[model samples]
Target: MNATVIIPAYDPEENLQRIVDRVWDLGNHVIVVDDGSDISKSDIFHRLSEKAIVIHHEKNEGKGAAIKTALKYIKENLWDCNVIGVMDADGQHLPEDMEKLVMKANNRENAMILGVRSIGEDMPLKSRLGNAITRFVFHSLSGVKVSDTQTGLRAFSYKLIDKLLQVEGTRYEYETNVLFYCAKTEVPIIEVPIKTIYHDKENSCSHFHAIRDSYRIYRDILKFSLSSFSSFILDYVLFCILTVLFPAGGVGILFANILARMISGGYNYFMNCRFVFQTGTKTQTALQYLTLAICILVMNSIFLQIYAGIFQIPVYMAKVLTEISLFVISFFVQKKIIFRHKVSGRGMIKE
Candidate 1:
């Protein structure tokens, strides 16, 4: 199988030439993207250009943009290439591990292969903590358990290139976005255990900004939750107003809950469709969303009754608890079932 390796470099370390030479020894086409490295690094790229295909960005666009640029060049130039591998320019990813990823990709058809690193005591505390938090959040959002969500070593078939290129995020979050998109689209992901190597414990050569990039990585989830929160506020306000305006009884509570949910659910659906999920074919998605809303409405009313009537919790408190519990359920259902797109073939959604 014809394969090409893409290394996205941004102010790389001094050992770049060694990394390129090692990758070249694997007998695959190598493409190195210089993401606007400073003039001091000019000699490095200049020397490496003779050994590998080098693409230069006028300015630092971020790792995702660099990878996209390499993929674009490959699609336009290397028509015979079937597999594309992406790895960091730093020496963290061993050449042997990448070869294993390539082998795994070649064996599997239309799959994205990830070189999963075993997080051990030797790993930096920040790296370990960051990966742990990201893994948990990713699993909660995408329903996919990935050991190493931030690993730079990954391989994918050419068939998935177009979809991956279209994935949102131009920074560190781009990798996380790829996993989310793949999980949502039902793209097969194969994980292979690989070696973990950190250059420096405290101050690594890595360019990842923990705070700024973490926000970017979790941006999608934040947006979705914010939309839900806004709808919740509207729903709660309407429910409170109706409860005050109506008699205190089962019939009154049920009536108020249904009306509140219907209004807020409609608003929530509109926001989710336009911003959160961004699925095509509103007819089917709306139907599914409405069905989900009805289900949640029933559950919400039951919980409200149990909390407010049986447990003697205040009606407002019961409503708050019930909605909070239902919020988690709603997010999963919408992500996995309601807004998931059905691809025709090879799991590629058309633009």
Candidate 2:
């Protein structure tokens, strides 16, 4: 299978050696990145050097950097390697599980394989709670549902190395961004059920700062959501105000709807470029956004007609339904089309 296993170790212990030895025994090459662990942990890496290619950083970088380091090494040196595996060094992942992921990668045409764990009572409480709270980050932003958004155990073909390196994130958020990258690029994610092994149930060795790193992963989407919500409030409130001022009927409602959208859409476009998506107001991007806005406006009018004109529902209730229905579609369109990222040849995000 010509697979290479990459383990990013920070103050790892006996299990690191065990995983390396077992992977080597299974006939897979291993690359161990010493992510600036203390001098006390040097010996473990030294011993691993005999069984694997050991790369050390003088200072601590994050897990994302370590994985990129190993990927770069593979892309430069090991051209024959067809499959690449990445796993945590804290002993939560079993070598057999890694083998399953690698095997799955080999069979898949163009997809990243995830060794997804069952999040339940058997797992850490923080992990369980985090997954429960944060799966929305994936489904809401990318319009893709991933069972394990933060699983460290992942395998992909050498072909995806460039795109993965291009994904932005340095620490824990890197894993989350990788999933987003795959979703963006139309790379399928194949999840394989793996054993959920938590070596220490309480106070685990994971370096994931739950609150801090989670914010990094969710920050962009959170800001965009707030921007969208604020824009909707402006749109709806102004629609109501204009309707009252005219106080006509269906005709007044239509006029108010268009007027409110023009105001709120302008605010949304500004906020998305300046604050939410962080994109420049290039002409092409502006044109694309305008097209989307027009399409959404038409869709909004149709929904309002169905709700208010035909069904005789209150215009107020119809406005809420129309906005809610379009939220996900509008967000995804703006993200995928209007605010797309550029990828460099060596896998860096240019903007």
Candidate 3:
């Protein structure tokens, strides 16, 4: 695969040597980014510098920054390297599992590979719950169903590296940022099984404060959720205004509803295009969204009329019932059709 393994180390006290040895055994070049670790204390990392191309950051730049540096070096060198794998410096990431990821990356040179941890067995309670929350956030915000959104054992093709380098976050939340970027660029993600080996004695781990880091990840995906809420509010407020102005039985009702939907839909399109997806807007993007909105409106109106007229349900209650049904179609249309962000990185969403 002509692959290169990039490991970003920051005050790494775990089994870094073993990881280095294993990457070498796999017959892949290694790039260790020492993220401002004290040279005196990190003697082992210093020694391994001889075996791999070491990029030292005098200041402790975050993992995202370290990756950005390594990616630049790889691109500048013009390495024939097709696959790039990354994992933790801690002994948690097994050498054998990494090989499995590399093999998968070799076969699917165009996909992003994720090493999914089988945390179902012997997992810490805090770790499990934290991962669950992150997983929910990922699916809700990105429309991508992923379980272990925070797993460190990941691999990506060269094409993905080019895109990943453009991501903005420079901390532990960088992985979360990558997920959003991949979604935007249509990166294929698949997950392979992995084992969690937590050998931290005092658990005085890196600066990855779970609460603080999780908040950052949440913030990164907030744009999508916020955009959706904005659209919902716009639709609801406008619908109310139209209903009051036109009254239910007037001919003006249909036109008012349709116009209100278009107004709200426009707000959603612009927000999702610029903030959520962060991609260049296609000429037909707006038309596609409008079409979807029209379909939703028709479905909603039909359901409402049937329920309110035939079933004798209250008008407001019928509207609510219809809106609930529309949720499924709206989600499917946005995920599978309209905002069809293809996953490039290979990984399964697990919790």
Candidate 4:
């Protein structure tokens, strides 16, 4: 299969030549998306164009935008390319490691290949912490454990071209968003070992702003979690209303309990369908609701029976404890299975 290397460059006229030479030497086609680099530096991309294709942007768009442009160009031109790989222009990724990534992509052909970096000596402390947090969220939300979620060195088959084009993030966060979209679509992904090169820190011109951009990444993960939190609030409110209407007698307690959980379950289903899953929330139909209620009833019975037997806790107090436990499990399941959104990022140099 024909392989293509996509490099998103911003004012990297000097570094561009070095990267282009390495990629060209590998016998792969190269596409450089210039995110509004000045024309006076034309000689750089112009020189590389002799060996590869160079597309220039008049205004500086985000890295995500540049990738979209390059992919679109490939599709429109009908290039006979199969695998597409992305790398940074700031010289952070080692050229030699590209072989492993390319080979892995070729082998898998359909799976998205992530080049997991071997974080060795002289790694920045802030970068380390940020990558760790991103990795945790990716695993927790999507059930996919990745060591480096923010690595720029990733390879994908041309079949994913249409999928990547459908993604919305226009900045650095776009990388993470694509991973989420892939997870949502159930596309297979694999991570391969690779080496990273950190130049004596002088050659890095990364625009990633840690604090500001991290907030964006965190905000994305929080969106999927809203359904569970919403269910908890709904449950509590329903319980309060039921208790107000009927005192804590046998009949009052039974009716109140059933109604509270039912209302909360319905609300949770509604929100998850429209907002959280972004797919049809009603996919489960009435049977799904009935099944969910049955599960909740069974859980409630077990918890209430255990509490009544061991501890002399009141029914209301036992119910509260059961809800709390369910909340924890619901959050984990919603993130990991139902509304799982995998996110990966290399941090942001800009807000």
Could you arrange the candidates by TM-score from highest to lowest?
1, 4, 2, 3
Kindly provide the TM-score of model 3 when superposed on the true structure, using C-alpha atoms: 0.73
Q: How close is candidate 4 to the true structure, as a TM-score?
A: 0.77
Query: Per-prediction TM-score, please?
Result: 0.89, 0.76, 0.73, 0.77
Report the Cα lDDT for residue 338, model 1.
86
Per-model C-alpha lDDT, please?
0.86, 0.86, 0.75, 0.73
Q: For candidate 4, write residues 1-351 as lDDT tens digits.
A: 688888988777487788888988988888998889877777888887887788898998878899999899889885688888898888888766776687777776667788777654466666777788998886666665667778888888888899899997777788887776766566665777776767654324676777766766666456646766777678767876897899766567567767888887888767766776565654544455456556776686577656744686877687778776666566565555454444333221110
Give the per-residue lDDT of model 3 (tens digit) for 203-294: 34545777777777787356656776677778777877887888566355565557777887788788877876665478666678778888
Tell me the tens digit of each residue's lDDT in model 2 across 286-307.
8998899899998998899899
The C-alpha stretches of model 4 lying farther than 4 A from their native spots are: 11-13, 36-52, 58-60, 119-122, 180-188, 199-204, 211-220, 249-254, 283-286, 297-323, 332-351
Candidate 1 lDDT: 0.86
| lDDT of candidate 1 at residue 88, scale 0 to 100 | 91
Q: Of 3 and 4, which scores higher on TM-score?
A: 4
Write the residue-wise lDDT of candidate 1 on 218-237 in tens digits.
Answer: 87688889999999999999
Off by over 4 Å in 3: 1-3, 21-28, 36-50, 58-60, 78-83, 103-108, 130-149, 156-169, 172-192, 200-221, 240-244, 247-259, 279-283, 302-328, 342-351
TM-score computed on alpha carbons, candidate 2: 0.76
Residue 329 of model 1 has an lDDT of: 93
* Error in Å for residue 61 of model 4: 3.8
